[model samples]
Target: MQRVIVRSSRGALPTAAKLVAGIGLALTGFFTASAILPYLPAGTRDQGAGLMSMSFGWLIGWRVIGRAPQATMAGAARVGLRAALWLALTVLLYLGALQMMARMLRGRYHGLSEALTDVIAQGLGLGAAAVQLDVIAMLFLGGVLSAILSAWAARRWQ
Candidate 1:
């Protein structure tokens, strides 16, 4: 075998860390907003949380992914798409995890012989609950804000 050298992209940790941070902020923000805006609709609270978190993710992705803000308009669109895609993927995974946890809590499907259809149906149902427009829109906006804020933070600190 030929000699091989392996190196990992340096941005991976920052990207993952930022994703976790953004998720935490979204959850905390939702709870805080729920308490502060007692009369706010559940949907509105969820939208606000998504907006805040996604904007943060956008900034994080900007810094981690090297899509500079000074690029052409098309470049900016690509950056936005990148962050949005990340969010979509994350949402799917998270929903799937939640579905699995819910099933475990019910103590069902513990056998190897269990039909895969049951699992797929459960996952799909949870996924459907997660794909609201307001949620998607806020996630996009949050991603945009993340791009802006991450750029600003990098400028200030680095």
Candidate 2:
């Protein structure tokens, strides 16, 4: 009988670059939320939105941007853009899901399919309503800056 050896590969631990990127994006998320929160229709604004955005930004920064392959400044910028989009989409979906869950709790949605549909619809609506020049500019600038900083940190620390 032959014994076969199996080895599992664990990924590298998180680095300074990840931390820097996460912090950068987290601030970006918080500030962007702040920029738009005031404009939300009365009674519909949730005070926790900024915190939620920060959480999403940190997560995406650590998981998406941080895990991306190290590259040139331009490449880092691209990665940052992608990460930013992911963060935006994640926040949107979460907001939508929250709304759907609230409706479900209220017995507003009669079927699972309807609830799912509502989630998408709500997300689109939220995204549409949230679109503003300040928000876009902040996200774009923040993402690019964070990415560049991340790249620099990677090179500096590694």
Candidate 3:
């Protein structure tokens, strides 16, 4: 007789699809809170939050698709195309999600039009400059700090 059993990979996902989805969610949250939140006023927090969430999804697309492991030109091109498609889809979904969330949180925003305008204006004003700087800084800091800490933690944990 043959028996079947399912094995767990703990918190890890085996497939690329699952891994990308998980990374998208995590990066969205991290980018929103750590990078985008502080730049916005309280009333416009939701808008910034939404946009940041979307941006992270695109970032994940770039990471997964555009920056695949070094390989043949054809393989690289395929990965690039896939990444671009995923990035575009992620942006669209993010916008849709933001709109839905805005409707759900209608009461929280005093006026949709005015709040949106303010959000857009603020976004435009600091979007290109401050946000980019923040992203770069955060990436640098997080990369270095995490690497050091991860090494330390691994040694200790082992």
Off by over 4 Å in 1: 1-70, 110-123, 148-158
RMSD to true structure for each model, in Å: 7.7, 2.6, 9.7
Better model by lDDT: candidate 1 vs candidate 2 = 2
Q: TM per model?
A: 0.48, 0.86, 0.34
lDDT (CA) per prediction: 0.46, 0.81, 0.44
Pick by lDDT: which candidate is best?
2
User: C-alpha displacement of 13 in model 1, angstroms?
Assistant: 9.5
lDDT of 3 at 16: 44
Candidate 2 per-residue lDDT over residues 111-152, each given as its tens digit: 999999999998787788889888888887888788888878
In candidate 3, what are the lDDT values of residues 37-135, reduced to their tens digit?
A: 455444443455555545664455435532332234454344434443444344334444554456446664566575565445444544433355665
Native-vs-model 3 lDDT? 0.44
- lDDT by residue for model 1 (18-135), tens: 4443543344324322332332323221334345434544454535334344234454445555665565555444334445555566787766445345555544554455556665
Cα error of candidate 2 at position 95, Å: 1.3
Better of 2 and 3 by lDDT: 2
